[model samples]
Target: MSVRRLADDQVQPAKFAFNRDFAAQAKVWVSKYPKGREQSAVIPLLMLAQEQDGWVTKTAIEHVADMLRMPYIRALEVATFYTQFQLKPIGTRAHIQVCGTTPCMLRGSEALMDVCRSKIHAEPQHLNEAGTLSWEEVECQGACVNAPMVMIFKDAYEDLTPERLAYIIDRFEAGRPQDIEPGPQIDRVFSAPAGGLTSLKEEPKPAAKTKAAAGAAAKSPAPTQAGKPKREGESETLGTSRPVTPTDQKDEANAQSKTGKAAASRSAGAKAPAAVSDPARPAARKPAAAETVASVAGPATPATAGLSDRSRPAGIDRPAAPDDLKLISGVGPKLEGTLNSLGIYTFKQVAGWKKAERDWVDGYLNFKGRIDRDDWVRQAKALAKGGPEEYFKVFGKKPR
Candidate 1:
């Protein structure tokens, strides 16, 4: 860290006080901490001062010190420690901080600095001719992936070229910084591959099924074993299914009779089930006797095989232990429990959710697109494959 101080011989006003709204906000901030820890509101109070005066002035720091009942130097110590506070004056409209770290340096941040020189003062912290724009080169803003970025006030503008930076400066000088969007300047999501996703591009789409597969699916009976008798001690597996009893058969018959004419009419128009094909095979000679294993498996579900509303997802099994879903950036303990309740107990399950399923979950949880915003699918995919190592390799950082 470098030395930070107020301008020498700079005279502060005789008195300073926050406006009505800021005074209320300041009290709210001070009230957040314990009784004796009211001084902990120093940082936010300093920020409030900065926002009011557009920079941290000597008088503003003193006012904040008075508000917190701390020594004046104590407030000065904090104001100078954080680079976020501008000790001196700034451009009236905007102060741009260009990132000059390794990533931005490699991505032509020097070109941005040159643009700043031509537009604003040759030295940073000095206002332009119109006194509306100023710029300084700073360290990385943690947007290394979208290199060559600059922050104007509170918002970051990334993936900048010299020409783009020039345009941004012009807009700010013209009192119209809102004209520019604040992230990548191309058709891409934040920090994603510029050419689009490289891995995990195989999200399932509704593909047209082959004729054979479609016919096979149609011919598969919904009651292949429906009428079969359950031997002693047989049990049901599907929650909604049960063995047919005499009472059930009688009720079904009565219901059919009630709608017999409509049923006949509908049956006349319904398409016939497709035929099944078997390939020719030669008979095999029997040699050894094989022992049969008794299945401890629960009762089968044949009536609801093709009905998605009644069928469980194929090959999906509840794990003996759930994954740590809180590893995802936006997921906390409460969110992890919500996902578990939704049957998303594994990284693979979260990774496999397509847009439709994600939308459903997002709506159910009232997250409103937070999944896409945090790129949860991408994170879950990496976690599902190789845990921490894969996550680090893919994202260039560890999972949360």
Candidate 2:
């Protein structure tokens, strides 16, 4: 790692203190640790400071150190050690961190850096003339599969071309960064194959009927001997008049050993009494095919069969002007199309979903618990009650 130091003295503030909200948040972070281990909060406190001021100043570092009751050097060591902390001021609107790791480098990260240099500034970590756009080349951002990516704030724009990067910079500069969706810029779903799935294309068929038939056959009773009464648990052996008793079989073997005449012993032993079944005992049944499958593989995913209509949110005719469901954080373009397909065209429809309805939609999307986690209903309610103004007021930021 390169030596990381604080900004020049002229740029450093006279002093620092967390604001009221940040102070409360700092206390919450500090409380997460034991009494004497408040120093463990130094990293989070410095991060909170950076989020508030847009960069970590020397004063902010010292302030965090004081709050945690640790030596200033200890806090400074942490801030300098982690590249996440911005020791100097960064762009107020967007800071593009280009991933220059091996994967990204092989995938045209150098061209991305060139675009940043030409558009934002001649050098990394420098802001544009407007002070709203800045960029720097950094290590991997964990999207190697979507390599040659650039991260603006928390969102990554991947599979980038120089032209696309230029267009993105312009959008951010124009104060409409949300116009460009995050993730792969091309036709890709997360890290999936860009041209669609290459393997597992065929849907799995249901369990074969042959297995069930075999199970049924195994459960059926065995055939009885010809011209003889069949008894429970009694089975016939070929070429024998009756089932041989253990003692008769042993005597026949002894007779055969002494006289070398097994045919006579067998003839004598063939007249032994048949074996009987216990009247009180019930027969054991083999498990059905479905039961056997369930025992081995557990239950099938509920999403595969889908949910009942009763749990589905009611649909409506497409309105002349439908609400943009994409504004909801978790709902992307593809997700919005899916919602539209389900007749969910307005925030009112989404906001009205009961827990069961939400669960149905969640299962249909195979989103696990993301719907609840993102609070889609609450976001829909806010957007439905009032437009973006209300959503911004409620969420303390613009709707995604």
Q: Candidate 1 versus the native: TM-score?
A: 0.53
* lDDT, candidate 1, 176-290, per-residue tens: 8789888888767889999799898887889788999999978764432445444433332221345766766677677778789778887899777896554685565654433
TM-score of each: 0.53, 0.63
- Per residue, candidate 2 scores C-alpha lDDT tens digits across 12-77 of 999988888777777777877898998998888888899889999998988888877788889989
What is residue 52's positional error in candidate 2, in angstroms? 0.7
Q: After superposition, which runs of candidate 1 have C-alpha atoms over 4 Å from their true positions?
A: 1-3, 8-12, 203-400
How far out, in Å, is residue 151 in model 2?
A: 1.5
Name the top TM-score candidate: 2
